[model samples]
Target chain A: MKYCSHCSNEVTLRIPEGDTLPRYVCLHCQLIHYQNPKMVVGCIPEWEDRILLCRRAIEPHRGKWTLPAGFMENNETLPQGAARETLEEANARVEILDLYAAYSLPHISQVYLLFRAKLLDLDFSPGIESLEVKLFEERDIPWNEIAFQVIRTSLERFLLERRTGAPVFHTGKIDRSPI
Target chain B: MKYCSHCSNEVTLRIPEGDTLPRYVCLHCQLIHYQNPKMVVGCIPEWEDRILLCRRAIEPHRGKWTLPAGFMENNETLPQGAARETLEEANARVEILDLYAAYSLPHISQVYLLFRAKLLDLDFSPGIESLEVKLFEERDIPWNEIAFQVIRTSLERFLLERRTGAPVFHTGKIDRSPI
Candidate 1:
C-alpha cells in the first residue's frame, strides 16, 4: 500500500486521531487501508472408515502429513476451494458433508476452514504438491508428525466427535509458544 | 522443496519417467512437500426479510457494499467463522441456517464458503472495517457495486433460491472481470 488509489499519490502509515495502532492512510483521499488475514480451506476427506492424508513435497513442513488444504482463490466459495484442494492434492473427488472446523491464528494472520467430506471413489494418487497420498484410520494417525497446529486440532476434534457421536464445539486462543 | 528433510541436501522437482507433474524428491531423507490453498468463510445475514450489507472500509474494493465476511480463524468451524464475521462486521448475533454457496477461483488463488444465517437481533452498526452498515431488500441490492465477485454471485443465488426454492450448485470458473 505504498501508493494511494484515490488520488494516485504515495501513502504513509500513521496513527489516527484516537487510535493506538498505526494504519496505512492515503494522504490524498484520507482513506485508511485495512489489511486482513488470508483464509485456508480444506477437508478431512474420508473413504470407508479412513481419513485422507497427504505427504508434503514442499518446504515449511516438507515430508510432514496434513489434510488436503490450500489458500482460498478469488471468486470461489469455501466448499469449492476445499473440494478443489482435495482433488489437487490427493487426486480424489469428494462430497462435502459438513463444515467441521474453523480456526483463527492472529499470530500468522491466517484463518483455516475445514470440512468433513466423503470420498466419491477409492482411487487417488499424489497430486502436484503431494509426495504420497494415503488414508489412515483414527487410531493410526501420525499425531506427533502432523504438519501444522491447526491440522492437528481439527483432526483431533474430528476423531473425538466421530467416536462419541456427539456435537463438539471448542473456542480459545492457542498458546503457540513451544515447550 | 528441493531438499531432503531427514538429511538436509538438494533434491529434485522432476517427476519420474512415467509421472506427470514435477514433485519434490529428496535423495537423502526421501521427503516431499505438499502445497494447498486456504479457506475463507462468511455469511449472508438476513434480518426480517432484508439482508445485512456492509460498506467495506478496505480494499481490494474500498467503500463497496458486501456481506459480512472474513477468513476463517484457526481452531474454529466454518459456521463459527461465518458467525464471527457476521458479528464482527455487523455487530449482530446470527444463527446459521444452511450452507448457501461455494466458489472456487484459481486466478486469485482463493476459495470462499458462504452460509445463510438468520439474524438473531436487528441491532447492528458498522464495525472497524466498515464505513456503513444497513439492510436492504433483494430488489434494492446494489449488485453492480458489490465488493467481491464471490459475494455478488452468492447474493444473487441466495435471492434466487429464496424465490424459486431451487438450490444453486455452481462448478466452474467465475467471471471476475470488472463490471
Candidate 2:
C-alpha cells in the first residue's frame, strides 16, 4: 500500500488517534486504510463415498490436488462463496452442509471456512483454474499431494468423522504452515 | 477506489482477464484490487449464570448494549481475535471456547464469528469504545436495547444451550437486515 486508493496521494503508515495499530493514512485526504484478515471459504464436496478434489493450474501449489475452494467474494454468504468456488473450479453443484472447519493462518492473515457439502451429480469437469477434477475415495485420497495444511486437516477429520454422521465443527490455527 | 494503492495511478473498475468479477485495476501497473468479506469476531463471555455486555460509546448503536466484538485483525486466530475484542471493549479477560455461532451479514459483506467464552475475572470496566460494561443474568438481558441482531441471537443461543452443556455449532445468513 504505497498510495491512497481514494486520492492517489502518498500514504504514511502511522497509528491513528484512539487506535493501537498502525494503518495507511493518506497525506491529503486523511483516509485511514485498514487491512483486516480475509475469509477463504470452500467446501468438501462429497459424492456417495468419494470426496471431490481439484488439481490446481495456478501457482502457490500448481499441480497439487485439493478441495475446490477460493477466497470468499463480496455480497455473498460463506456457504454461497464455498458453492461458487466449487462451481468455478470444478463445475460441480453441491448442497452446502454445516461449516465443518475453520483454520486461521495468522502468518498469511487468512481464515479458511470449509463446509461439508453433498455433490449434486457426477457430471462435473475442470474449470479454467483446474487441470483436472476427480472424486477420490477415502483410501484413494492423495494425502501426500494435498495442497495446503488447512485443507489436509479438513479432509483427514472429515473422513474420520463421517462414520458417525454427526455435524461436528472443527477449528485450528495454522501459523507458519503451507496454506 | 479511484486510484491504485500500489502505483498512485488512476484505476478503473473492470473484469480482469480470466476473472468474473469487476475489480479496481490500475491503469499503469495493471494490478487488480480484489475485495472480500471480512470477519467480525467476538464472544459470549460468561461467568456463572450471568453474561457480559458493553454499552456503546460510539455510533451505529450508541448507548445500546452489545457483546464485545470488532473487525478481526491480522496475525491472530479466530479465538484470539474474539478474546482481544473482549479485552478491548470491556477490559475483561476471557478463556475463548469453541466457535459457537457464525452469522453471515451479506448486506455489509461481513461475517460474525461468535464464540462461547468463560469470563476469567470480575475485575472489569469499560474501555475506550464502551460507555459501560456489566454482567447481566439471563432474565435481566436488555432485549430491546441490544445493539445488533447477531449479538442478540448469540446471547439467546448461549443461554439456551448452556443447560445441556452440549456444544452445538450455529450458522445463519442475515442478508438485507441490521447487523
Candidate 3:
C-alpha cells in the first residue's frame, strides 16, 4: 500500500481522527488501505468411520500427514472450497455435514475453517500435492507426524468426540508454543 | 521469504527438478518455505426468517450493505470465526447451521467461507465496524446496493432455498461484471 489506488498518490500511515491504530490513508483521495488476513478451508472427511489423511508432497511439512485442505478461492463458497481441496488432494468426493472448526493464527496471519464431511465413496488416490492418500482408523493416526497443530487438534477432537459421543465446540485462541 | 530463518542466509525460489511451481529454497540451512493462502470466515445469520446485515463503517465500501464477516483469528475455528464476527458486528449470537458457500477470488487474493447461521436471539445493535445493523426479509433486501458480490450471491441463494426448499451449492466461478 505504498501508493493510493484512489488518488494515484503516495500514501502515509497515520491514526485517523479518533482511531487508535495507524492506518494507511491517501493524502489525495482520503482512502485508507487495509491489509487483512486470509482464509483456508478444509475438511475432516470420513468414510465408514475412517478419516482421510494425505501425505504432503509439498514443502512446509513435506511428507507429513494432514486432512485435505486449501485456501478458499474467489467466488466459490466455503463448502465448495473444501470440496475442491478434497477432490484435488485426495481424489475424493464429500458432502459437508457441518462446519466443525474455525481457527485464527494472528502470529501467521491466517484463519482456517474445517468442516465435518462425509465421503461419497471409498475410492481415492493421491492428487498432485500429495505423496499418498489413505484413511486412518482412530487408534492408528500418526499424531507425532501431523503437518500442522490445527490438523492435529482437529483430528484429536474429532476422535475424542466420536469415542465419547459428546461433541465439544472449542472457541478461543490456541497456544502456539509448540509451533 | 528468500532468507533462511535458521541461518540468516540468502535463499532462492526454485522448482526442485520436476516440480511444477517455484518454492523458497534456502541454500545455507536447506530449508524450504511453503506458502499457503489464508482463510476468511463469515456468516449470514438468520433471525425470525430474516437475514442479518450490516452497513460498513469502513472503506472500501463504507456505508454499503454486507453480512457480518471477518478473517479467522488465531485461536478460533471456522464456526467460531463466523460466530465471533456475527457477535462483533451485529451484537447477536448464532448457531451455525450449515456451510452455505466457499469461494476463492484470485483477483483479490482472498478465499471466503460463509455459513448459514441460525440466530439464537433477536436482540441486536451495531458494533464498531458497522454504521448500522438490521434484518431484512427476502423482498426487502437491498440487492443493488450490496457491498460485495459474494454477500449478494449468498443472500440470493439463501432466500431462494427458503422459497424453493431446494439446496443450492455453487461451485463455478462468479461473474464479476459490473451490475
Candidate 4:
C-alpha cells in the first residue's frame, strides 16, 4: 500500500517489534496493514442427479462454467456464505450438507471452501454475474469449458466420491502461471 | 478505508453495477476494495494424553489460554498455515493428522480452521505473542480460563471425540454482542 488506509500517511515496509514478517506500517500512526488470504466459499449444488453450474458474465473467465461461488462476506458463516453466493450467482437455493473441498491458491491468495449441497429445486436462472445457469449430469459436463482449476478439481472429486455419498475433504495447492 | 491505496484518491461506498453489497470504490482509479472474511488456521497439538495451550501476550485476549492459531498468510496451504501458527505461538512442531474443526466467527469476520495434530517433541516454549506455553490433560484444562469461545468449544470437542480416535468435522457460528 502506498498510503495508510487509517491515517492517509505514507507507509513503509518494516517488521514490527516482536513480529517476524514485514508489513506496511503507517509512518505517522504505526498502524500495520496486514493482508490475509480470503475465503471464497461456495457449493456443489446438486438437483436430483445433476449439479448446478453458472456461466460467467464477467471477465477473468467470461462464459466459462463454474460452481456458483464468491468471496465470503462479513457477518456470515462459511455455509451461509456458500448459500448466499449460490443465490446471488444462480438465483438458486440449496441445503448445504458439509464442507467438501478447501483448495489453497497461494498464487492468488485465496482459499476456496466448497460445500456439498442439494438444490432446493430446479427453479434457477442466471443472476447478474452469470450469463446462464444450468444443470449438468456427470457425462454431460462441459469439462473443457470449466472456469477455475480448483472448481474443476472439486467437480472431479465430487463425481469420484458420489458412489459412497460420503463427504470428501480435499486440500491442495494451485500453481497458476502468472499472467 | 478513506483513501484508495492505489492512487491516494478519496473513496466512496457504493454498490457497483449488478452487485448487491456496497464496496469502497475509488473515485480516481475506480478501484473497488471488497473486504472478505479471513481464515485463522491452527492446531490442537496433542502429545500423548495432553494438548498444548498458549497464554496470549497480546491484546484481544491477553493472558487467556488458547490453542495456537493466527490468520492464514499468503503463500501457504491450510495445513501449512496451521503448522506455522503452532510453531510461532508455542514454538512447537506438530504432525498434522486431519482438519478437525472449522468455526465461523461472523462477529469477528474470521474462520478458525483447527487441525488434529501430534506434537513432535516436548521441547517447546512460549513465542513472542504468548506469555506461557504448557500442556494440559483433559481434566487439568483451565476451562474457565480459556481464551475465545471457539477455543473452548474446540477443546471440549477434542476431549469428547478422543475416545473414537477419529477426526471429527465440525462447523458452527458464534454471535458476539457489540461492545
Alpha-carbon local distance difference test for all models: 0.74, 0.91, 0.75, 0.87
lDDT per residue as tens, model 4, B1-179: 88787777788999988778899998788888888888999999998989899999998879889999999998788989999999999989999878888889888888999889999999999998999999998889988888888888777877888876865777877675321
User: Model 4 chain B: which ten-residue window has the lowest total lDDT?
Assistant: B170-179
Q: What is the lDDT of residue B34 in candidate 3?
A: 55
lDDT of 2 by residue, A16-135 (tens): 998999999987998999999999999999888899999999988999998998999999999999999999999999999988999999999999999999999999999999999999
lDDT of 4 by residue, A27-116 (tens): 798789999998999999988889999999998899899999999998899999999999999999999888888788987888899998
Model 2's TM-score against the true structure:
0.97
Model 3 fnat? 0.22
TM-score of each: 0.55, 0.97, 0.57, 0.96
Q: Which candidate do you rate higher for DockQ, 1 or 2?
A: 2
The iRMS of model 3 comes to: 9.1
Considering TM-score, where higher is better, how would the candidates rank from best to worst?
2, 4, 3, 1
Q: After superposition, how far is residue A124 of candidate 1 from its true place, in Å?
A: 1.9
Winning candidate number (TM-score): 2
TM-score of chain A of each: 0.85, 0.96, 0.86, 0.95
Error of 2 at A82 (Å): 0.6
Predictions: Cα RMSD each? 9.0, 1.5, 7.2, 1.9
Ranking by lDDT: 2, 4, 3, 1
Model 1: what is its DockQ? 0.11
